[model samples]
Target: MYRHSATPRPYTTVVLAMSTDGKIADVARSPARFSSKSDRTHLETQIALADGVLFGASTLRAYGTTLGISNPQLLQLRQQGGVPPQPVQIVCSGSANLDPQMRFFRQQVPRWLLTTTAGATSWQKEQALGVGSFERILVADTSTGGIDWNNAFQQFFQLGVGRLAILGGGELVAALLAADLIDEFWLTVCPLILGGRTAPTPVEGEGFLSTLARSLELLSVQTIEQEVFLHYRLQRS
Candidate 1:
């Protein structure tokens, strides 16, 4: 995993639901509502275990709202652990071109924004007018105009996010995989196959060479009716 020697970052996990052919969404890039209620509950359990939930701009736009803990037992667990009822919902975007009217702004969970300088400038005017919804904004960009993930995770650690969950739209997961920042993955494979050339996968970047591909160690596998849940840990070098 990518770790800063001077700073301890959160233990990051990527949670996703994909079709049997490995498509997270259809060609239209619409919200992924194909998963069953069991999968939804599984996702909620993972979110409840995390200190923060992160998603890319595309995922946020598709859903228009972040998932909050509705299960009473999960809420009680968070209370017993001294964390808020809902984990901080974090949106990671480079441009931060988000609609303020989206239902996400009205959600009861704590919100955080992770963006670059240019993105932050777009929101600064709103914050000045006291119309911003984010409780915290972090700008962590690299010299090459990419996200400085190490720095970003260090900031997350400083903010008390010891465990981070990544809900994907593919691009974000690919970036973290490229940086070797992701630690674990929870993949739910549904029965259907969404066959489209433009469909999004769980990790979508230029992809890695066979020689440099990341390795994963299988942790567990569970089969439920029509879906299979696979848990894997990144095999760190």
Candidate 2:
């Protein structure tokens, strides 16, 4: 298990589903059902376990996700954990070109916008007041074009989030991986193969060199029909 530092912060977990060839979406960047029903259920279970659920701009635009946990049993589990009935919904957009009218913002949950300096300006003008009832958090300046991952996590800690779930677009996951902030990874591998040269993978960015690559320790695995679910804990060392 990756241990937390002296200061309290959320356990960052990335939950994603891809095909056997490891593509989140098809070549056209269009959304499609690649994972099984079981995998979808598992995703809800993970969401129920989190204090906050995060998504990147591209994912949001592609799926128009509501970020809601639909199962009543899952809601009960959250209640038992002493977490809120609905986990906070968070969206990170470096460019802040999000549409306020998107279905995600219409959902009833504490929504938060984590954006960089450039994003703040775009958001203020494009998104009207009371449009989406989200808390705008501006991360301090950093080299990353997007909000600094380290600073965002610190802010999440200050907000009392103890477990955060990431359902991402590859670039966002890459940023977290580069910062070494993600603790656990849950990957659902569907049986199909999507062999598109332009298809997005689980991680995309200025990737680490072979010698600098991070490692993971397999935690558990579960199979349902043709789909396989994998759990791995990041080796913090």
Identify the candidate with maximal TM-score. 1
Stretches of candidate 2 off by over 4 Å are: 1-7, 143-145
Best by lDDT: 1
- TM for candidate 1 is 0.96
| Cα RMSD for candidates in order | 1.6, 1.9
Model 1 scores a C-alpha lDDT of 0.91
TM-score of 2: 0.92
Question: What would the per-residue lDDT of candidate 2 be over residues 1-237, giving only the tens digit for each residue?
Answer: 235566556898999999999999999888757777888899988988888888888888898765588799988887887778998888888787887888877777778888888888777776557575476555545785747677788788778777899998899999888877899999999998888889999998888999998999999998888988999998864
Put down candidate 1 lDDT per residue, 1-237, tens digits, no spaces: 237344688989999999999999999998999999999999999999999999999999999998999999999999999998999999998888888888999888999999999889888777777664899999999997667888898899888999999999799999988876799999999999899999999989999999999999999999988999999999975
Question: What Cα-based lDDT does every candidate model obtain?
Answer: 0.91, 0.83
TM-score of each: 0.96, 0.92
